[model samples]
Structure formats: C-alpha cells, structure tokens
Target chain A: MPYLIWALMRDCMPRRWWFGFFAGLLLATVLSFDTNLGAHSLGSYLAYVSVFPLVLLFRCGWVLQQRTSQGWPHQEKLRDSRGYKAPLVEFFGLSTLLLIIYVCASIPCWWNPYPSPPASAGYYPVTIHFGANDYWLFDLHSPVPASSTLLLTLDWSQVQNPEQDVWIQDPNGRKLQAIPGELLRWPLSPAEAKEGKMALHSLPKVGVELRRPLTRLEIPRPGMQQGPHLLLLQFLFFWPLFAMLLAWHRRGKLSGTLSAWTCFALGSLAAMPMQATDLDSGPLALLARAVLLLKLALPPVEGLLAAGARMERLAFTSAATSISGWLVLGALSLWLACKEKRPVQP
Target chain B: MSTATALILDNLVLHRGGKRLLGPLSLNLAAGQKGYLAGGNGAGKTTLMETICGFLPTVEGRIQTATPLGYVPQEPLFPLHLHCQDYLTQLFHLGCNRSMNCTQAVQEALHRFQLAAYGKHPIARLSRGWRQRLNLAQAWLGNPQLLLLDEPQTALDPEGMDCLQAAIQQTTAAVLIVAPEKSGCSKLAPLLGTLSVEAPCLI
Candidate 1:
C-alpha cells in the first residue's frame, strides 16, 4: 500500500497540485499565527474544507475528462493485467495522502505549544452582576471542574439584611437561601451543576476557591478532535459521488436527470439558511430536510462548527455517520463500477 | 485455448447500451503473430477491440486469452500532466513487470519508441505523432503475450510509422491492430491476415 501511494504521488499528482498543496500549507501556517482565527474560523475552515474537493476534482475530474475526450486505454490495460483493483487503490491511496497533507498543514492551528498562565491554589476574585434579565450572573475567567466543592465568600457588609438580601442560585436558577455564614459551601456535581453563568441575588464582592488547586486543563481544540473525521467524511461523501457522476456521464445519462439532481442538491445545500429555524415549510423546507439528513449522514464543515465545544457527541455521530456513509457510497460506487463495465452505446 | 495461441475469439458477440453492435465473430491469433482489423466508419472495430480487452462485456460466445494482454486505444488518453518518462514508469509499476527495474524498463521503452529525447517533457507538450509513440510504448510495457492496438497509424509520420513497424516486428507478443484503409499495416512485416469488422469474419 505504501509503495502504491508513493507511486501515485510521484506519477498521478500533477505539478499544479503540489504547488497548491504548498500554497495551502503556507496559507494555513500564516493563518495559524492569528490566535483569533481558531478552528471555527473561516480561514481554518477553508483550509481543511478545500483540500478534499480540490483533490477529488483534479484527480477524478481529470480522469473523467480524459476518458470523455480521449479514451482511457490505461484502465483497460490495467484491468486486463491486474483486474480493477490497481486503479481503485491508486485513486484512494492518492486521496488519502492528500488528506494527510491537509491535516499536516492545518496542524499549527490546532496545536499551541506555549503554556498558559498556571492556575494556583488561591481564592480568585469573581465579579457578580445583574444581567439584562434581572438575574445575577457570576463571571469566572478560569474553568472550574464540575465536581469541585466551591467556597464562595461574600462580603455582606453593604447589605442591611444579609440573610434575605443575599442568596446564591444553583445552575438551574433556583435560589438557595444564604444562611448568616462567612463562606457559602456549594458542592458542584456533574448531574446538578455545569460550568456556566451562576446567578446570585445580591451585588457583592465574591471570591471562589476550589477544594483542590486550580489546574490548567489541556483541552483539545474542536478541530483536533473532529478534523480527521471531517476529512474522512468529506472523502466518503465526495469520492463516490464523483464516481457515480462520472459513471452517469460516461453512460450519457448525466446531462438531463443526474445533472439536474446534482444542481438541485448543490443549490439546496448552498441555500440552506444559517439558522435552522428559517426552514419551516414549502419545497425549500423539504429540500432543507433532505440536505439536513445528508449532512447528518455526512457532516460538512458547518456541522463540524455546530458541534462546537461539545466534541463527544460529534465524535460519536461522526464515527457512525462516516462508517455508514462510507459503506453506502462504497456500495453505490461498486454498483456503478459494475454497471459501467460495458461501454455505453453512443 | 491452446498453449501456443495467445488469443481466441469464438463466435464473440458484442453489445453497446443493450443494442447489438458487433460480432458473432471468431478469430485466433497465435503467439508472436501480427494482424490488422479493417473496417469503415462506425463498424464497431474499437468496440470489438475493447470487448477483447474486457473493457466491454461480450454479449455471447467466448473470448479467451492464454497470456496477459496489453491494449492501445484509439486516441488514447494519457496523464497529460505527467512527463513522458514518468507516465511510462507509472505504467511499468502498474504492469506485471514487478521483477524488473522500473527506470531501466521505462528508459528502454523511451529509447525503443524514439521518445528518449522527450523523456523529461510533459505528455501534453508532445506532438501528436510523439504522443502516439508514447501510447505504443506504454502498451509494450510488461512484455505481455498479446498486444491490441486501435488505429496505431492515426497520427504517425512515415518515420514514426517505420518505428512502430519495427517495434511490432521485434516484439514477441501477438500484435492485433485496428488499421484504417491505406494505413501503416502495409509496412508491418510478416503480417498474418486481416480481420474485416464489416463481415465479422477473418479473411
């Protein structure tokens, strides 16, 4: 397999593709320097997003165009000698290499070598303010573990009635009556509390301390967890579609039905409203549903971004979807390959 | 299917898009034999050759080959972005010549086809005649027992025609070429016979 990949890289990948690879690498590296442009940023999104399509288009499109314009006797020759497996290996091997290169190029965006400020064992001052909804929200710069026992020391010197005026609310917005205590002990549990805005009834100088020393957790960026899966899905989604389209083109069935379907599918994907609620009724909604199912089956970049900070679900769904999509597309491409064994009558 | 016969087509019928096109044809070419398939426009000559190479499924009868086959299609499409030598090298790797050195085999093919000077040149940069030679060179790789060339004389000059004839004559493979009227078939020495596609019978 490595030998085949090496052969394909040396022979199949054109000079322009190499140049594009290097250019994309440079662009990705340059974009990574801007900390503001992280995984979800458009630059990083385009960097990983464009590689699959570009590789697919150049490799498959070139083969299809050449087969259309001039006969592809090499395929026949290879088939005669070694059956059809060689070309299939060549196509997939080269595509995998390109995707690997894309991952390498986008590495800088996901990896940050510099260590952030260490979280020490001390009480950190927290600011408590009333939000627009009249609910008090606490702002903490550091991420607190869900299971930590937090000590919230409130200075009730300004409050006339310390018990009635000042109260702490749990994550669910239910108020917990504050007894006349120097420190309010709140035991955070994964089931009952989350790491988000915690409401307080009174405006006071608040300080929070965990049972253990605050340690900086090395949370992986969203792309680091989901990037490879996204690329794999991209390959699964596009490679077989291109093969099916090329098969249709070769069979002279592309211009009317398949082409229209392709255009409609693409148009529906492009016209998908930013907010999911925008798709409510009519043909657009139906198309949106179809597109949504397609996206679920093969999650696109938007799906990756929508996954956001919660990567576990994304990882699970991505694995399931990638496998399912790979199987379906694999079967479909195999069917097309079998159907295309005989030359179409002109 | 004899040990000495390279290819045998026994009453082979072909179809395209579910419509009957060519055949109920039969022919036998022994190893090292050379022949031409002649026909007018739209006679399914290329289709017949493609079917023989297993590119197209045969509708009826048996098409058997005793040895590995090589095919050169009419208006062959190459990786135009690849250099001539690189393309040949790829073919060598893809071919059944794993025992041989790829560079040496490719170099030999280039020299044989008189494409040695254009080794570094991109296939797209080559002239029509040179491209045709490159196509022939690729087909000759792996030293297959049978070689099928479709309109091998399409873009060849007189000198290119001579080069092709020499290569075909020197090769041990059974050479079956699709030749139009007044093609380089006349120049191909030790010609076995001509198979007319219009009649679907060997003459």
Candidate 2:
C-alpha cells in the first residue's frame, strides 16, 4: 500500500515535468494534429517505458533513504489506505483525459485529407497503343526538379514480320537509330508469344511521342523546364523541407540524431494526387496550382491505408505528420536518455 | 522472524551474473534496531539493502519488511528539471501518505539540510555534494520504519557528513549502514548497536 501510494505521487508531484509533458502535447497537436495510436506510437511508448522510468525510479529511491528521525505524519488521514485513494483515482482520471484530448486533437488532420503518394518518386509502369504510323506523346507533370525514365516493351502479338521497325526521338527532334540486335521479336515464334514467353521489353527507358513519326518516344532532357519558375513544388513543402534536412545532415552534426532525419525521410515519402496534373498548361497547370495550395494548407496524409489497400497514397509528408507523435516521443526518449551525458535536440 | 519484526531475511539468496552473490542467510531486525553493514567490496551489501527496499528480486529465499522502507544508494542522481523544494514536497506527501500543507515540510527539509538558499534551484544545477545533501534531505521527509544507507559517505563533505549523522539521530527507524571504513561511519557509533554481515558469497 505504501509502495503504491509512493508510485502514484512521484509523477504527479513534479510540476515542471507535467508542464513539460503538456507543452509537448500542445506542440505536437498544433504542428501535426495526429493522434491515431498505431505501431509507431506503440514503438514510442515502449521506448518511453524503457527510457524515462528508470531515472524516475532511481531518483525516487534516492529520496526514500532513511536518514532522519523525521517520519511519516501521525495524522489520521495518512494513517490508513483511505488517504491515498482519491489522488490515485484522480491520477487515473487525468490519464484518461489526456488520452482523450490527444485523440480529439488529431482528428482534424484526417478531415479532408490530402492524397499521399504510393512510395518514393519513380516511374510508374503503363501501357499505350498506336495506330498505323502511330506514335505516343509523353507529358511529365512534376512539382520538383524531378525527371522520368521510360521503358518500351514491344507488343509482339501484333508483329508478323521480323523486318518491322520503329523510330525514336526526343522533343529536340534527335532521332535514335533502330538497333537490329535490340529487336527480340524476330527470334520468338508466334507459339512462343502464345505461350507468353515472348512478351518482352525492347531496350527500355524510351519515351513515346506521336509527332516524331517512328522516333516518337521523348524523354526529358536535363535543364528542361515545364513552366515558368514558382508555378509548383518550389516555394513550399518538398523543396525547403528536403533542403533544410539535407543541409543539416551534411554539416556533420546529425550523427545519432535520428529524429529530425526521420521527419525529413517520412515527409519525402509523402505524395500528392496527380489526377489532373498530366499537362504543363491549361487545366493541368490550374489543377497543379490548386494542389500546391491544398498541400500548403493540409499536411497531405496518406489515404487511410489501415489496410494494404491504402499503400498507394502513402507518401513521405503524410507519413511524417501521421506518425509525428511517435517521432516526437522518439526524440524525447533520446533527449531524456542523453540529457546527463550529452546534449540532444528534438 | 515474528510478524512484528521490522525486517526478516529467511534463507535469502541473492544471485547475479549467474552466480550466487550472497545467500542461505537468515536474520531479523526488530523495530528501532541499528546496525553497521560491514563487508568487503565485492559483498552484496548494497544489493541486499536494495532488495529490502523492493528494488531487487530475491533469487532464493523469502524476505519480509513489516513497515515502510527508505533507502539511499551509494551514488545519487537527480533529474535536471526537478526543483529541490518540489522534491521535498513530493517526498513529504508520499512519506506521510497524504497531501497536506507541503510548505512546512519543504521548509523543514531545506532547513535541516542547510539547503534553504538552494531550494529554488533545479536538481541538475547542484554540485555533487549538494546533490547528496538533497538526497539525504529526502530521507528526513517521511518517517520511515527502516533506513538503508549504502556507502552514505561516497560524496559527502565533512559538513554533509555531519548533516547525515544529524539526520540519522533524528530517525526512529532502524538504520543499517554499509560503509567501507570505521571513520566513514564513526559518527554513528552511538547508534551502531551491531557490526555484522551474515550473507556469504559463493564467488
């Protein structure tokens, strides 16, 4: 009973600690507004258990030493188990309230959530068909200084003659010669195509364009700009966040500082919806502008992937905000663990 | 080992590192008993004291404490953010098992330990000797039935040692000191009713 009473009052008694705790919660809420307790929270809670309790226990033990004749109060309120019960109940009640508030504040982050990407930025595989003398046009919509690589897989099922050839070119009108050895459709029998053994890619990383005739594929050249500067991806979310984190890491100071880097990493993985940003001008650019504004207003959380079904929307920025609690807690764990030995900032 | 005994160790064994540190020992401490915990450096003096305080698990025997136990380890560490006054107030509430006026308790502890000026200071800001003083001051808050001082002289200055002695004299609980030298514990000679270490170590 004495032990139980002692345990209850130790945390409650520390005004500064409670102040720190509440301040942390408020900061996390305003910055992230994320409270879904998931694996990250569990991981962080486990870390909290592993880190802070020991020092608290050690300090409590240090204080509990018997040195003076000053003993427990003789007051009747302290004499029985009844005196400590109210505070214990109050502590439990406070805990529940905190949990509720933590959850309540995070609900807004999910309301009208932004679309997160399905992974790191990369090329998505797709298929296209062409008519006689037909070619494909490739348009890239990017908010950052990003480029794409194309892979051209020939539809061998439509081929009858091995002598058939196609041309390739860039928007600059430079033509790529058709390498005879690069065509694999010549060797495979139609029966092989029937068996699905001949379905193969011609040398890949090709761009498709209809205007250039046979050399229709176009890949973005270096130094290419889709639109005027500051139209997208430059002023906000992606560029600045990435640049700051990268600069910090490069200064040779972030050795074991996993928290800040994790934030950058998670944010980088976040994605925005690309439903209409398929062109450089007109409606696509307008859609891109609106999305840029949306991302600025909202933290673009991944669509609820609670199941693997949501994996497509999981991008870096969304992951960062969604797990911001775990990130902050993890950083706090580091701070507490390193407070005595070294300096750590979350 | 009657139910009224303040502390009892019946065939208690303490094991660490896959080896028995001390064990197959039995002893009883009556209320208000005082004893010197005399043992070699490798002896489980601190371990046994910590076990009695419920900080450790007994590997091989049954032990009992009839009253609330207070313990101070050899080295004291305080969180940087906690204020000395707050520490004392919390100690008072926990010690007395009730939340009453903590001002008096805090003042009394600060005065007793000569820490009145440092009361507002954070625990992290204090020097080592001051930290030990603060640690000793905590023991004076709740009148504990049993006090275990493991190497209480580790970081104490002469004045701090005197403060520790004064604090011990005020307690009615049994105090079992684990000290290396006689001079280190010389002040407690008046209350040092017995000098002993009953636990034997295997390695």
Candidate 3:
C-alpha cells in the first residue's frame, strides 16, 4: 500500500528532498521502542507515517539520477525501442486476486471456537430500583478474592426501553456512568485495597441503577479480554490490501479501479468479522450471526433458492455497483495522480 | 506572403559565465520561414537558443513567439517510465485545447519519422538516431506555430541529417535553427533560407 502511495506521488516531489525525509524517518523509528509507545509516543507514530514518503522519494530520485545525463535522444530511444505494456490479463487478474484477498482479510471473523485462557475474570452483580429523576441501587458486591486480581465488568442494558442510561456509584458519592458509545474496564487489586494504598473513598460506593431495565451489557471476562489482540490482527490483515491499492494507483485506470474496489470490499469484510468475534456477545450478536449464516450458506443455497436469472441479476447488479465505485475512485486517483510538472526552467 | 512576424527578438543580450554569448542582438523570424543563427562555440549559439526558448534569463531584450511555442532542447529531460506513444499523447493532450483525434495524429507523426515500428516502444531502449527522432516527434506532435531547434545536427549521420533538414524545410511553422560552427551551418544549409545573427533587432 505504501508502495502504491509512493508511486502515485513520486512525480510530485523533487529528487533531492525525499532522501533526507526517509532517512530522518528511519532514524526516528530506530530510536523509538515499541513498549514505550504510550499516548506520548508521537515519535513512533511519525516514524510509521514517514516510511511511505521515504520509499517513494528514494525510488523516484534513483530513477531521475540514473536517467538524467543520458540526454534527450537516449531517452527517446529508450521510449521508442522497447515496446512494453502491462499485459491486460496480468493487470486485471492481479487486481482481482488482490481484491479477493483484501476482502477476505477484511471480513471480521468475531467468533472463536476455542475457549480463551483466563487472564482475570469476575462479574459485578447489582440490583436497582427506579427513583424520581433517576434510578437508585438496591444492592452491590465487589467480587474480590484474596491473592487474585479483580476486573470489574459491568453489564448495562435497557430492558424496558432499550435506550435508557445506566449509572453506578462507587464507594464515594462519585458515579460511573455508561454512555451510549463507551467501554468500561476497571482493575481492582485486593492487595492495594487491603493495604489502604488507595482510599476507600476513592472507590465509588458500588450501586447499579438503570434508567430502564437491563437490555444489553459488555461484560468483560477472561475470554472477552482478547479484544485488543483480535482488533490488531484484524487491522494487520487488512494492511496488505490497502498496500496493494497504494502501489498500483499510478499504473493506470484499470489497476487503480481494481485496487480501490478491493480496498472497499476487504475493508467491509474485515470490519464485519472483527465486529462479530467478541467474547462478550452483546445484543447485536444475532444480527451479526444472521449475516454470517447467510455468507456461509451463500454458495449452494443462492443457486437453489433464488432463480438462476434472479441470482444472476442480483450478482450482476452487485458487480456493477462495485465496478462503478471503482470507476469513481479511479477518476479521483487519476486527478490526483497527474502531478503538475515543475516549470522546466525552475 | 508576409504574416505578422511570428517571432521578434530586439536588443537580446545574454551573458554566460561573465562572457557575452549574444550581445544586443536583434532579429525577426517571419511566419513559415526557415531561419538559422550561426556563431562560434561560445559565440552564444546555445545561449541564444535557450534565451529564445524562454529557458535562460536574457540580460536585456524583448522576444516574442506564438503563445504556445514548441521547443526541442539540446537534451530531452523526461521521466523514464513514459513510453514514446504515451509521451506523444501527453504532448498532444497538453499542447492542444480542442478535443481532436490525438491517436490518429500520433500515428501519422510516427509514420512520418519512420518510427511506426517503434510506436509502443519504451524510450529507455532506443538508439541515438531513433531517440533524436522521438525528440523531434514530441516537438512536432503539437504542430505549434513556432519551432525552436538547438544544435540539431550534432548526433545525426549524413543520411539522418538529410532527413531532418528535409523535415525542417517542410514545416509550415516558423523555425529558428541554432547552428554555431561552420560544420553545423554547412550541414543545415539545405534547409534554411537565410543565416544571420547580425540582422536588425526587432524591437
């Protein structure tokens, strides 16, 4: 993907500038350690961004230097003598393959058949009753076991309306609320709580009060802790698809279209699987499973259930939509690909 | 058959490395005329060509050509990845504002230069003669009203030079051939109508 990006931008940059750019990026990457990448790890992030431009700069500069002194006739001879065009089959086939791989990689495979090992597991149970303006907790328990670490995983759901807010009070009057789009992960060490390393007042008086009945909750457990790893893998798998796209961007209309479509399809596929594969299956699990079930049964069932002409029409329309999407992407890429040539004298 | 002169250079003075190349020079190249500028090695032939091509900064002068002039520099500086046909296409696309059948135009240009066989060829593999032809082809691809050639006679063999000279004479556009040495002048004599660097400067 970076190669594609570099190739696309090679003409826009001058030969002399890219070397130092890439070198500086490499230097920064070398200086940074992966473990040290906290929120403050700007160096590591910049280093990653630097790789593409640097590669592009070096490649373009090398080509420029190798050909500069050859003179006009030499260049013309080079252009005129050896006739070459990327074969149509190679172009389209490679694009199609990359697209498929990209799509497959992108498909979010959220389901894990094997049980995950327990890192730290416990659930927080709470009962609550409704108040005038909000809900008040009736009971709360800190599932703390001695010599073991406790991860507080709260399940928030709207049983009645499915759109209500849920709030919990720590030991202190301070409240921990579950917003519409948020994750809750709290670690409690029994040793610290026993030694009074942290003030009891700091721990909110545990109480669960839902604005409505519990309809859904993201309960964190030993199995569900694998979110980060799964997310990373999902991200990496989609990387190559994006890379192929960036590399082939400047090749021409066809390749550009294929790369873009591949990126889109792969992106959608990867996202779906990643989203579906949670150890903690939320209320949306059924919806995700239904989609997966259709995908699994698509090959044979599609032919048997749907009429041949109907299926053909559906497939043709889907393909047409994808092709059109690629065409638009190609047009945009081409517009951006044609670098404004520097004034010859300058 | 005088159309308003296509190119006019007046009091054109150019200095290279503290030496005067073209000094207070003046000339008028009328439309459709084949003209040449002859001088010694450092006598400002290339400097004059560069100046006319708007590539060099003139010390003191006024020069004008058709709005879209075609210049074939001594050396062709282009990207390596571009093929000959693609290059011609790019030139045709950039040079013209109107929508025309550029493919046919390109085919004709290739045939005219005897480069039809090398139409889809990559520029990196051609020999010197063919490459020169490609250079000329790019300049002629636009079919601009004004054409500028710099030391065009240097790399060509006798037969190749003859073909070039004939092409130059056949061009309908006004042309300025810069040939500084006696060999260059003698070689290009058949194509040009008059040779002068001491003519009245057209202000």
Candidate 4:
C-alpha cells in the first residue's frame, strides 16, 4: 500500500517523501486486513507475492536520487575527485539562478490580476475621455495634419452623449494627428477582425494607414519597450549562440539535443492550429469531437499523426482559436526536457 | 556505378570547429551489402556516419542515395516513463505507411533481441544494454534499404552483439556500422564485409 501511494507521488515526491507515503500505505493495508476478514484469509499470501510494492519503493528512491540529488551513485565520487560538487547539481543550480533572473526580466507585473477594484471604480482610473462625431472629426483633422471623417459602424450606445466632445488618442496617449479625408467607411468587413463595419483611421498623405479601428489607448514607456527589446536581443543574439558553443564543449549530447529541439519545434507548430481554432460550436466542435474520438480509439502515435494531418487540412479552410490541453502539456514537457541534460525522444 | 550501389559519397569533406575531420573521401555501399566502419574516438567515425544519415551538414561532399534510410545514433535518449512496448510501437508506426506492417516487425525484432520480458517495462528504467537494443530495434523496425549504426556495440555483450550481427546478415538491405574502437572488430560473422579505418577507398 505504501508503494502504491509512492507510485502516485512519483513525480511530486521521491525518496525524501517515502516515510510519509510508507506510513500511510502501512496504515491503509493494516486497516484493510483488519476490516475485511474475507480478504485477510489469503491476504498474507497475496501481500508476500506482490512485488509491486517493493518495486514502487525502490523506484521512488531512484527517482528522488535522479531528480533531487547531485549526481548518480557512481558519478558522485568522480565529481568530488574533480574538487567540486556534483556537476549536474551545480549546473542545474547555476542555470536555475540565471533562469530566475531571466524570468524576472520577463515578468509582466503590470498585467497581474490582483488588486481588484470595486465594481464602480477603475484600476488606474481612465485619465481622459473623448467622443467624436462629424464636427469633432472636423476639429480633429484641423488641429491634426489634414482633413478627417468619422466612419462609425459599431453601436456607439456607450458614448452616444452628443453634448460632449470626445478626444481621439494614440496608444502612446498622444492625440492622433489626423490627415484630410482620413476616415473611410466600407459596408464589407475584412475577416481578420470579426467586428463588422470598421472605422478606418489613416495618417494620409504621409502614406501610413491604421489597419484596425482605434478604440482603446494604453501608454507605453520607452523603458518598457527597451526591456523587451533587450530580452529579445539576448535571446536571439547571445543565448542560442552560447548554447551552441556549450553543446560543442559537451559534444557527447549534441545529437540528442538537436533531436529534442526538433520535437519541440514540431510540437509548438502543431499546437498553433489547436490554439487558433474556436471549438465552441458548429462544424468545428464536430471536428474536435472526431479528433477526440480518434484519440481515444487509436494509439497515440497514430492519433497524433492523423490529428496533425487533419489539422493541416483544416488550416486551409478554418482557423483555430484555442489549444487543447494535450498540446499544452506536450509543449510544456518538451520545454522541461530541453532544460535537462538529456534529450527527449518521442 | 551499377544501380546496386545503395549509397555513394563522393569527395566527402567534414569540418568541426574549423578543423577538418574527414575529407576528400569516397565510398559506396551496394544494395544488401553489410559494411563496417572502424576508427578511434574523434577520428570522425560518428561524424561520417551522421553526415551519411543526413543528421550532419556536409562541407564539400555529394552523397547520393536512392532509398529511405534508418539510423541508430550512438547514444540512446528515450523519452521519460514510456513503456518499452509503446516506445517501439511508436517507432514502428513512424516508419509504417498506412499498412502497419512495421508495427509487427518491431515486435518480432524485440523478441529476437531477447527483450520480450521487457516489452512492457518503461524504457526509462532499463539498463544501458537494454537501451542499446531498443535503439537498434528502432532502426530495424522498417527494414529500411539503408541502415546506419554508430558505435552499435558499445553496451552489448558478446551474445547480444552476435544477435545484432545476425540481424545485419539476415537483412537484405545495406549496412554501415561505425565502430569507433577496433577492439571487437575480429568477432563478426563471416558473411559481413569489414573495412579498416585507413582504407584507401575512404581516402
């Protein structure tokens, strides 16, 4: 019984956790034998014959050593002989340190959902409000760069107060510089953004056009842009090249790493479609159901292959909006495997 | 060259870290001919094999092959917690076209390698020897026309090696075994051909 519980905790706990698992299992097994007199008749024989319990205990210990300890039993002394702690442990610790730093740089503290406001209040409080009609549009074009027009399609019920003049602003919180005849209304809406009848706002004469309707504004500091840019710079220009160099230094594992990255790339790409398609209703839900059925009936190998092919076909005709849990799990597993010293072969 | 040549490398040159490993070399493997590659570590034996298997890029070589190739890399890196049966089945299905014949062939190969008991064992729990056998089994799953093995016998005992040699001999496809160490080269069965590292043909 201890072993069964340990097996259940294989990923979450290892040898260090064995004591609690063992005690719990022992209690359960004893209780079972005490309560069920019929099972007790042959229970001793069954318990003696069952090796899974012992195997599970040993396996848990092995996993603990592999996951939490410094090195393999044979490799521990070798590491000490080199006048250092276990290289595997040290490497992981150091990499984890660096990763924490990297993660900190990427943290979107501004996007955290904490500090909820009362229903009547805003988080930071919208600093400005503006409404624009034909007269306001004309004022915007005049003060801005050129002539402008208002192309209103969406129901403006929220901002229908005709008495007040509304300000039109850019993402940087700067008032948009409008050009003459900047707005154009079209009856047919592009399939990209589903909201029909888009209001076109173009910085005309300068040859720049806004692809999407401007409805919201959020100011971005130059420092924020630079933070992401620097992160990208390090990722694209430094870390990958460094990893390649390190791979060469540890030439023993290059092929494995390459294969692992290939799996990651493929999985990430395949996950895109599943992430994009909306599976809430219509034929899409039927297709999702078919995929689910195939997955349950066929082996994972065949199922993944068929699903990939089916997705390829659907990609040409439809778009995906949400990824299945399986793809997310696969991608996360691959990423974790990549961070390890070994390659993950599927 | 006759159509029997399953693979041909012409004027092959490989470079690692700006150092030339093997270069100005040429070789050919006719269909169904079993060949061996013997060399010291870092002598570019694996490099040459990887280039042939299309895993490594070529610097100044032209390799011509007319059939699908199967390769067993020197190291075995199995995914975590996967049962042996499922692992082999995955490899089998990968090589299988919609027919699923390779799936049965994978099972047969596993039985031949004395791994039937471990058919259900998780590959993660296996010893290095068992892992090596699983690697070799994956290569043979499809009975590919061209098979490349890198340090194929590193973890095998004598009998295990003999079983592999038998598989190579029984195969109707061409074989290229990259043996980095020359210690065990003499024990191969009489049917397979051997080539020394210093062969004039490779140069």
Of the candidates numbered 1 and 2, which has the greater DockQ value? 1
Off by over 4 Å in 1: A1-84, A95-99, A106-285, A288-346, B14-23, B181-184, B187-203
Q: How does residue A148 of candidate 3 score in lDDT?
A: 29
Interface RMSD of each: 6.2, 15.3, 11.2, 16.3
Worst 10 residues of 1 chain A by lDDT: A209-218
Between candidates 1 and 3, the one scoring higher on lDDT is 1
Q: In model 3, what is the error at residue A14, expressed in angstroms?
A: 20
Q: For candidate 2, lDDT tens digit of each residue in B1-203?
A: 45456777778887667777777667677777666656667677777776665555566887777555566767655545568886676556544544545677678878888999999998879998898888777765656677777877777888888877787787788777777655468567333332234534222
Q: After TM-score superposition, what is the CA distance of residue B154 in candidate 4 from its true location, in Å? A: 1.4
State the lDDT of candidate 3 residue by residue for A59-150, as single tens digits.
Answer: 43333233334342232222221211111212233334333332332222233233332343233333343333333333222222233222
User: Which of the CAPRI classes, incorrect, acceptable, medium or high, describes model 4?
Assistant: incorrect
Each candidate: RMSD: 9.0, 17.7, 17.9, 21.2
What tens digits encode model 4's per-residue C-alpha lDDT throughout B79-194? 54757776566444333444546447767879778788998898778888888888787677656777877878879988789888788878888887767445564354222333
Candidate 3: Cα lDDT at A154: 37
Off by over 4 Å in 2: A1-346, B1-4, B91-96, B189-203
Give the per-residue lDDT digits (tens) of candidate 2, residues A179-258: 43452112223232122121222223342222222211122321112111111211122222322232232222232133
Clashing pairs in 1: none
DockQ, all candidates in order: 0.19, 0.03, 0.05, 0.03
RMSD of 3: 17.9
